[model samples]
Target: MRTDMPAEIWLDPYRWEALQEILEQDGTDIEEVLQNYLIEVYSDRVPIERQKEVDRRIKKERLAAVQEAEARKVFCAMHIREHGQEYILMEKNGREFLQVAVFLRRYLRNEFTTPPQRVRPGI
Candidate 1:
């Protein structure tokens, strides 16, 4: 997992201290406030196509995560003849497991070329 680093600023100490005092009075974290401000600005100035691209990337990443988690839970056929434990088994030996793994793998591959698009209102 990637740790999010706080945004770096080049403000002088005087103004920085003033901002900190204001934030202390408001009981808000600077990072949260900055994030909200950035989001607001993004919504205001970013083009719809660019926003859609970002949305697609986020959706694709989320889909990939769900697929990977589900893959870890892929069903393995055990107790079958010649197939004792499916710990390292693949393909027909694992039946449905192969299809799911392959399907997810292909889906992610396609995502690399063409991420799934998001539907938006008034578009």
Candidate 2:
């Protein structure tokens, strides 16, 4: 969301391109390549010097995925702790909908606070 940060940190065009190439290669396992890339490319930290290019591409989807996963975990825990299989229903435009909207509304309030850590391993 911050424009000052470099793009590649989230969006690795090179890695993606590499994956594309590997996909085209005979007998090249794309999954293996992706696994290796994740392990090798991000296992350490992205240097500040390289952050411009590396961090620039960090995608919102990645952050959203991380955030959503965390939110779901928290939401489920809260639901189990605070409210069991209890659900309410409301008719909106003659459509009955399971209304846990209030819970979700509250969950979203705290969801963005604890973002996934700086996942750039090489930094």
TM-score for all models, in order of appearance: 0.48, 0.18
Which pairs clash (backbone N, Cα, C closer than 3 Å) in model 1?
A: none
Q: Please give the CA lDDT of all the candidate structures.
A: 0.62, 0.49
Writing each residue's lDDT as its tens digit, candidate 2 over 77-121 gives: 122223333332222232213445554554456453543223233
**Which stretches in model 2 have alpha-carbon errors above 4 Å?**
1-54, 74-123
Candidate 2 at 39: error in angstroms? Answer: 17
Give the distance in Å from residue 21's predicted Cα in candidate 2 to where it truly belongs: 17
Best by TM-score: 1
Stretches off by above 4 angstroms in model 1 are 1-6, 73-123
- Against the true structure, candidate 2 reaches a TM-score of 0.18
Which structure among the candidates has the greatest lDDT?
1
Q: What is the lDDT of residue 34 in candidate 1?
A: 84
